[model samples]
Target: MPGSTDEPTEPTPGKPSAADRAARVAAMRRTERARARRRRALVVAIPTVVVLGAAATVTAVLVNRPEPPSLDAVTTYEYAGGDHVSETVTYAENPPVGGQHDPVWLNCGVYDAPVRNENAVHSMEHGAVWITYRPDLPAEQVEELESAVAGETYTVLSPYPDLPSPVVLSAWNNQLAVESAADPRIDAFLAKFVQGAQTPEPGALCSNGVGTPTG
Candidate 1:
């Protein structure tokens, strides 16, 4: 053994030292902590962005909205006739004139009501009298109605002039007849206008006695 040329032998196992293993574990823990921090930041940031966006949308909606008009400002009238029929006409806050039709004209009562049939029945029998006398209508347009219903005319029961603004008119026979107009009137013979009817109650006819029946 003293004369052998080989070097003294050492252990040949292939495991890491204590310091190298500890360093590797520390690096893995640091990477895990970094990933957790990223996840938490994403959760908080996404909701914050969504909430801010929703608030901005609601603000835009409120700022761009328009105010609505008041219904209480309109003037209304009630007219009566046979068969327990009655009609109500509502005038626009700003009534147009001279045979012009305004969108504000609408029938607010039942068709069987005395006043409901005034304009609807007469206009059908005669012509577009409501369109002829609207406050917004020009004199030329009113004349046009005369031409349209030249030979065939019906009675206008309301005292108000045919003009642009809603008005209620009526005719009566076996069934009550009523018509509505933003503006218009009918032309017919006096006797023929009331051929088969009785007169309506005085105050129950026009608005504050301002309109007179023409049939």
Candidate 2:
């Protein structure tokens, strides 16, 4: 043993053993697997969170939306349309819901004077809501009706001679007579009947027709 060049074997410092390298590789693998699990969790969770947020938003909209008003008092009529006549046609209704209409539809807007019955009826055929009030109504009340139809293309506001009520909203065959300008039914009528289902000719041009409008 003394003559041999090889002496007692000694472990080298700053060198990893086979077991240590295997342990380090196993640890790294475990850490990588943990990271992969976390990434998968986030991938699954993000869409779930988005879906929950979207569902919550839809629920809030449904809950906060205003309920439709009751249209129990609205008077429905069965009037014939598309009857173009040249002469002044006498209608059974005071404001003339729908009957013989002029060939030209009156341009829809705010009118300070009494619009012709024949022309206005033609407008009604074209899905225009005619809001007529008595000529003698207070200026402020007249303003209220005008404001309701302001910037509206499908509405006609004018004065009618000897109207039965202070305010009368006529849409084709549908008519609603409200006593006061502040009546909620005025809005209700417009909501339900502006280019509504009962329209004889929906999407008809309310503009580019006859009569000069104040607005």
Highest lDDT among the candidates is held by which one?
A: 2
lDDT per model vs. reference: 0.28, 0.76
- 26-129: candidate 2 lDDT, tens digit per residue: 44434344444664322221222356546532122211223334667778789888889999998899889998989999999988899899999999998888
Give lDDT for model 2.
Answer: 0.76
**Model 1 segments more than 4 A misplaced:** 1-82, 85-132, 155-215
Q: Each candidate's TM vs. the true structure?
A: 0.20, 0.70
Model 1 scores worst on lDDT over the 10 consecutive residues at: 94-103
The count of backbone overlaps in candidate 1 is: 38
